[model samples]
Target: MATSSSTLPSLVVRMLRHGRLGPGLATLDLGTGAGGLAAYAARRLGDQHVTSIDVDPYLTEAASERLARMGLRPTFHAVDATAEIPGHYDRIVCTVAIRPGTGLRTVLGALHEGGRLVTTLAGTSLILTGWKHKTGELVGCIERGGAEFMLTRSGHDYPPALSELFAVASDEAGDETGTGRYPVMDVANAWEVRSMLEITTPGVQSRYSTHDRRRTLLLIHADGSWARAIGEWTDPPTVHQGGPRRLWDALERIRGRLNMEGALPLYGAHARVTPDGVVHLSRGQWSGSLGEE
Candidate 1:
């Protein structure tokens, strides 16, 4: 079971302020692991309109008890949000990241026509918010900042870690060695840049570290793709790429595109979710789409 129910204070404030959790709105807290957000919603929306759920019976029971200890009582259920969402709500806030098209539809179906939902996608840090429309679509924009939530789970634990793939990626002889076009930029720390790369070439994981005067950047993907770059602070680094995809090449291309455009696409972009739950994002002359599959 994913323990994503506890919304941190800063993010809670941000979501409440930026996500438009208006007064007296009936809200559903999807994946209520520790019931923090559920309790807050109960205080704001009244317990009658607050329904929290999780797939873990133990989590739901504990969360139910935790809410009662605060003298706040809202409905709690051990239900799969992607399979069975109980009642229609004016605001459905999900803590667990969901696959976009297929699983997202399940959450949208539980929202009232004018209601809204706030969530991030699995493996990326973009906080997406959407408003349900009478036309059977959800329209909104990505929040300026992002969040990472554990994916909702049906079983007690996730499938085995990707350690086996990582093992081969660590020391495999990469296919090419060349001078990097850009210096080892702070790719991982820069959320916007990292989020863009993750969106475009999904599943590439990155790490950065400094040893002596040299800076290193490592990229690995579950699909046997890997890249390594080593350079000084101001110099172009040497790069090696292995497996099928050119992981570092993808990052460099995205960097060039962003440098030319002068901005990240996460902010002020139009987000349109079709009936099938595909989220289309566009701004000015640029566009991107993310789907569950």
Candidate 2:
């Protein structure tokens, strides 16, 4: 079975808080890995009103056994979350991120009008919440804080990553060579920067490493573009990029904006998820989207 980890208690509480779960309300605890969220909800709101589902039958079955021993028996199901859910819910709190197109639409379709949904956007750590409206739209804002969660899968295992492209990025001396203004930093560890990059330039895979005093950062895209930057600690790196686009330049521009503007426009921005599953984000004069129009 695919590796599954339980959601931390602190994060579970935070997500449940945003869900505003209450007694007599039917809550769907999506991604029931260790059944942490399901257990919490079943206790507070009666097990009959809580339903937990996961793609892996092992996780759901194990969680069911444990929760049963604890005197809680919320409904459990082993199913693909990206497909149609079985029942409507007053509140749907997903422990996994949902891709911004069909997966999102499936979840929203399972929510009753006036219901609420909380889930992170795929490719980002953004915590997005929305209230089901009579117009078949979900209207809400990106909350201030964020959480990293695995994306929903339709099968027993996730698809392969861009490992070949990553390998090419590590060795290629490309069409353009230059020096970056910012030092080589671990993009994976910088949540805000990484999240913004995913929002603006979706599907950019990154790898970072250090050896002795030398640090390197590599970025690769599915479109055959790749960039490699290497430098000593705290100093700007020599950048090498090849492909259809200059990937390093894009990262620098994002870094430059953060250095110049002090913040990104993702968090606290108003988010509107249409029935078509497009997420439109707007903050003041800036705007962005997760899926195509």
Candidate 3:
């Protein structure tokens, strides 16, 4: 009951394309919300070769029941994926985003040698794919057209939400409001731009709204940082920001960089995650990292 039955057809197709599925190769689908990906895999790789797991018993039960009706029965487990899995697999595709340094090592341990695991990072929209080496590590990169998924969780519900951060952001007015150098840009809607902003500064959530014909973009972080921009995107918007950090300026800087470079930096970078879950990305001098979870 903690999950809804939903399917991103495009995401399923993209995941399958990069999953590297082959005949007779055992596959594991982690976080099987409604078993869409598992059923998709069952069609290509056969039900006997697929195993799907989720932390919610209701989800597992519902998925198992649905698959049975289709005459395709895949083994389903209502267990935590961050813990030791019941068996090994040739390919592990996680539908939920995994935080850096959080249970990624254990998931990799469940893969056979040279097996592939595809997942997105928790804080950013970077789809990472890696091959498990006999040396007990996974090396991969930011796949093209990155994905966003629900964060991997153990409990029935998400943690006490971002309400506190949003409350502060909605009320605070500390920094000066001035004409922005660039026209108001919808940064959150642009995937590449949003991904760059996220990787550069994690844990920032954005909310955009409109009231009485005027648009507003609000930026909030758990660290008491907040910023707001009000006006049309094509016009110079008034920006008000406060807290320990300059949030709007950071976004403007990224927009400026993208204007010069013609693209964001994260899409094609090489990613290397050690067993301890330290993620390093480098493509030329543009190197960055996601610290341990």
Candidate 4:
């Protein structure tokens, strides 16, 4: 069900602004969906300075033809971005979200020293924009604004979601049951909470639904962790959690912090991505890391 979509023009402009595109700089339009970003960069920076890449050959070929018709022809490549990117770039702006792994490392490795990278982390709306530091880390801050993008993939489709766990969570009783401190919410719609949760506890999939005056939220992790909550719209839900961790409790902790502090540490946080693909984020006394040992 997950498919790539063209980024809106406003967002394309926003990403380019964060990328800091300028004259004569070699730029790579990563994830050249619909070629909007590629067209803009080629027009301003000239076609020779702009290169666009996509995992799908069809997209690469189609976009190449369409942009050529528009009198813009940036270099186009059909390759898996997570593997090995062909060339170094002064500025890399990815329209797709990437998890912290080989894909992220590939993007980081393709940047020249002092180059800038603007992309979102997969499964979260956190837009990370940073410059390649002398020490090889990408150091910058998470933008106060957020965006949602389709995750980058190596093939025709994304990996399957944790549907089996979702099925179990829906029917089975949990090892622990209690009343929640907060009302049952569509966690995916609560962007900051969802983003912070993903940072703290990755690989969790969330599903939410409502019926009459009731609402239900389900969280399932690939590690066999699961949580289910059902209650009235404005009321705290009865929560059930099971497996290696209490998923509901983890979410409640994040929610409690948000209520206590009035904001999350994710937004406007200082971020550092090491050469090995680990991401470290800090905001004042609160700190978190992803893909760490």
Per-model TM-score, in order, reads 0.89, 0.97, 0.91, 0.98
- Which digits, one per residue and each the tens of the lDDT, describe model 4 over residues 225-292? 99999999889899988999889999999999989988888889999999987889999998888766
Poorly placed runs, candidate 2 (over 4 Å): none
Native-to-model Cα distance after best TM-score fit, residue 136 in candidate 4, in Å = 1.1
Candidate 3 residues lying further than 4 Å off, grouped into runs, are none
Off by over 4 Å in 4: none
Per-residue accuracy of model 1 over 1-293 as CA lDDT, tens digit each: 33444668777656655546766788888878677788888888789878888888898899888889989999998887768788888888878887777778788888899998888876567888888899989999887768767787766776655665555555666788889999897676777788778778876777778987888888888888888888998799988888889999999988898889887767767888887778888988878877736
lDDT of 3 by residue, 1-293 (tens): 24444659889878877889999999999888988999999989999999999888999999999989999898999887766677999999988877777578778778899899898877677898988777777888888787778887777776766877776666766666676777655566777777777777877888888766677888877788888888774677888888888888888888998899888778878988787766788887798777555
Model 1, residue 281: C-alpha shift (Å): 0.4
lDDT against the true structure, per candidate, is 0.80, 0.91, 0.81, 0.91
Candidate 3 lowest-lDDT run of ten: 1-10
Mind sharing the TM-score for model 2?
0.97
The per-candidate count of clashes, in order, stands at 1, 0, 0, 0
Worst 10 residues of 2 by lDDT: 1-10
Model 4 has an lDDT value of 0.91
- Candidate achieving the largest TM-score: 4
Worst 10 residues of 4 by lDDT: 97-106
